[model samples]
Target: MCALSSQVRPARSVPGARARPETAHATRALILATFAFTACFYAWSIIGPLSPTLQKHLQLSEFQTAAMVAVPVLLGSILRVPLGILADIYGGRRVFSALMAFSIVPVAALAVWHDALATVIALGLLLGVAGASFAVGVVFVNGWYPPERRGFALGVYGMGMGGTVLAALTAPRIAKPLGLQAPFIVAAGVLVVATVIFASMARDAAKPAPRTGRVSLVAPLAIFRTSARAWALTLFYFLSFGGFVAMFLYLPKLLVGVYGLSKIDAGSRAAGFALLAVLGRPVGGLLADRLDPKHVLRVSFIATGVLAVLLGFSYKHMVPLTAECLTLGVVLGLGTGAVFKLVAQWFPDQVGAVTGVVGAAGGLGGFFPPLVMAMVKSATGSYTIGFLLLAAVAAVALSVVSRVRGDAR
Candidate 1:
């Protein structure tokens, strides 16, 4: 009990209290953490890019193919909660190193033993461990920055989303020449190198965060159930980050259906869409530092709602559709950065637990919209209703932002 109790830190009665990071290591910490996160994210989402190849090799049914892609997303998304909790208690350095070390096993397994549907699905569940790195990296980066600057630092860290872009670009190109297992081989090598670099260099923020309240593994769940602020933030991220992820995964299919573009062209554009969001994070963080995060949230939600509405009407038009999609990408990235800015501002002392809950919300949030879009498209033969539903959700979240704090916007 004593050893177990030592690993899990208690909660703070006061939120947003922590010493400044050791400046000497701050730059080094940010760089190494982002690098490690990039490799982890590559492992997390690489299956999406490799799915078609896997489907051909395994002769998988459509349902089976979809399941293989989705299992990792589901497991990786839900795992953020406990992983974040672990990062806080055990420290990001140990937790991150361990997570990647374990991830290498599944990556290596999939490279060689991926013939049967059951075997692939089981290994994919293990690979989801890589996606949990976000919560860990956030807590890790949060430890290194003061409350005011976390918006920017974490935003820079969020650039790790480029891992998806990298996977999209690299998986097919490399697999065409080298065979199906080659991409997994390369990803495993990257993780191995990243694990070594991170374990050697990363440090948590200065120790012993003020702990006036007792906490446990389930503390985040309790707060998630009880706290309206956490819920509000969760909803906002659900819309913003969730929307970003949904679009990342679904845009190619959307383009092919609506514009009748070739698969290669649609995929290239989807990669570009992801790039826009990747670039937007740091900008969003900078805006959060300069302006109030509330302002950032308001602009992001309002703009996102408006753009989504525009997209619904213009889905068949190539130019306007592209413009709206591109703008939506940047706005969503800003909302993601601003949400964490609020976390640092309001719940700094509980960064990891709170982040776990919020990050899990973001992850789970991505699941519904693609489902909605597909269902609405199937039933009505138009995606307008699905998008309008998304806009309605955004407006509701904007209202939550108005009431979440003391002021109305």
Candidate 2:
């Protein structure tokens, strides 16, 4: 583990002195990777806000509409592990560019094809690669920083998750004006640009020491078994990242359904929630560095449970409810950054693989909230049950953290 950890850590020149030129180079890499990865992730999540418009245009039922939007995320969850393996073997620079280029085809196809279900499912599969970009960015950025400084650098990269903020904000407005296909066309063009930039400028560590042989498929499973810390972090990440993605994809629908807001209005409010949460992400990481990560996480989950319950019950009072949701978003966002910092600390060697395993679980974690919402609404004709469940889950996560050792983070 120590040997593998060194391979991912950047080579340092001065023991105690700062070098300006090297700093500039690393800063530039960080900025570019953040933007590129952000655009890719943003494109991955564009379907949620646009679903209602597409449904209305095609005269589709609610169930059909939900499938179109949710299936891509489900696919994305499954793809992260293999994508992480690819990054481990080939390096992020090559794999990220190739995947982005490959994504262009399906995105373009969505632009040209008018068939609703077929287009959505096909494009959704293609876009799963974008979620894989998380592994790409992590491996890329981790190569630029030492283990001690890695949390902040990766925290900033994680902040690129703000891309979902951009998507939540703009997808509906853009789709409304230029029609459904325009967003895909623009997303594809942006991807092409990102691929070109990454190909030309991105750097990797000198070729990794030759592996003994291909690692077994059971490697990640074995790591999971040996490290109780990994499981705890996984649960925490499930609560934080899971809540973030779920809200990103479904908040617009929640707003429209419960609050009786128009699609445009609901989208804007959802965007506001995402934007606030994005700002909170880096703050969370920064806090982890100052306070104990376990403590930071404890507070985050507790606040999340409280806010989630408040928002869940707030449907009766729309004005105050919006404020409550914004608060929940911030708490969940901060929790996400802190949780990743914990991962970096515990599984330093398997950052990419661990990130993939934890991330895939997080994605699966994301899948449930929407389904729960649907089921509860279907059963009780209200979202109250779903929000209560979210609160309970968060509370359990908080309790679990209290039992975990403080040094793990």
Candidate 3:
């Protein structure tokens, strides 16, 4: 139901009209939008790398820390759909800049108010602004590329998701040396700079040739209602992107508690897991472009399921576990890229809304696994049960994927 001014204007009959500005403007917008997303997401995920330090300093339990980590993700997931809608109705340039600017306040507060639990929770929820940034990027980026080339363009822009790796690799070590609050101040600074750059430089392509038929508020609902394949894609994303986010959030804990790694070592390991995905993401998109997105989804789900199960068994053996985590990271990253490629191809005209729906599904998928691990660990003091459950979710996703038939869309 949301709408934006058209990006591509109809050609005028008048001779020598300037048309080149549109192309140059759109390219700059894409770069700025990408930068904004990377910074916001980097800040959003810093909690993962800093969890152990936070726990030790604040004297918090595992459940409390897990809840702290999940809060922004949950809020962000819930808000993405609406934000996407808002982007479409208003415009991505304004929405994204404002959100990024607003994120700085809470991150700055966290820098100064480090010891208060209520302060942390409140700040975490506000950081969901980072999560909301994804929708804006999707709408913003999708406007720039033509339909046939969109997969690669979005996939390239999708590299911004790996901002989590920034947190994973640096937060623990940086916070350790400078004190825990320092990273937040750094994150806040980055957000403010990113916001200014995005607002000043980013521009939207003319909105897609507007659909002639009325776009209902229920337009996206029609996707779920009419396309069985939509749900399959949702499940596929749940397994792929969901697992990606969950692992990113929880990998520090897994490293420290399950493997007896030091906090710094755990952050590096978690960084390895997240950093590897950046390459896998674009590769997945390339594969989807060359082959069938559905087939890619099926194989990814099955392979990721097997690897996750193997990882559970490998947990006790360090060498095997490391190999399993690496494999899991690559497969999930490939799948994530493939799923978004399918979305762009499948609903070319409705990329904004479709991206919103799929993006939300991916976020929701990311939300549950950490909570599952938290509950499982709280009850049994082990992650095995949780890993097995993820394996089961993957199996279900793969099974469901088989029933849906379609081309990329």
Evaluate all candidate structures by whole-model CA lDDT and list the values in order. 0.79, 0.75, 0.77
Q: What's the best-to-worst order under lDDT?
A: 1, 3, 2
Deviation from native of the Cα of residue 104 in model 1, angstroms: 1.5
Best by lDDT: 1
Residues 14-120 of candidate 1: C-alpha lDDT, one tens digit per residue: 34446454365677788989999999988887776666667678897544655677677677778888888878777788899999999999998988978888998
Candidate 2, superposed: residue stretches over 4 Å from native: 1-22, 212-217, 406-409
Model 2 agreement with the true structure over 286-332: per-residue lDDT tens digits: 88867777888888899989887887777668787778888888888
TM-score winner? 2
Model 2 residue 91 lDDT? 70
Candidates 1 and 3 compared: the better one by TM-score is 3
lDDT of 3 by residue, 1-409 (tens): 0222344442211221222233654566667777888898998887778888888888888888888888888778767776776676556877888889888988888888879677788888888778878877887776666555555666667778878988888788788789988999899889988988878766655432344656454555566677776667777877888899998889888878877899989888877888777768878877887887778778788888898888776787888888888788888988888887777666654555666777778888877788889899899877888899989998898888777677533
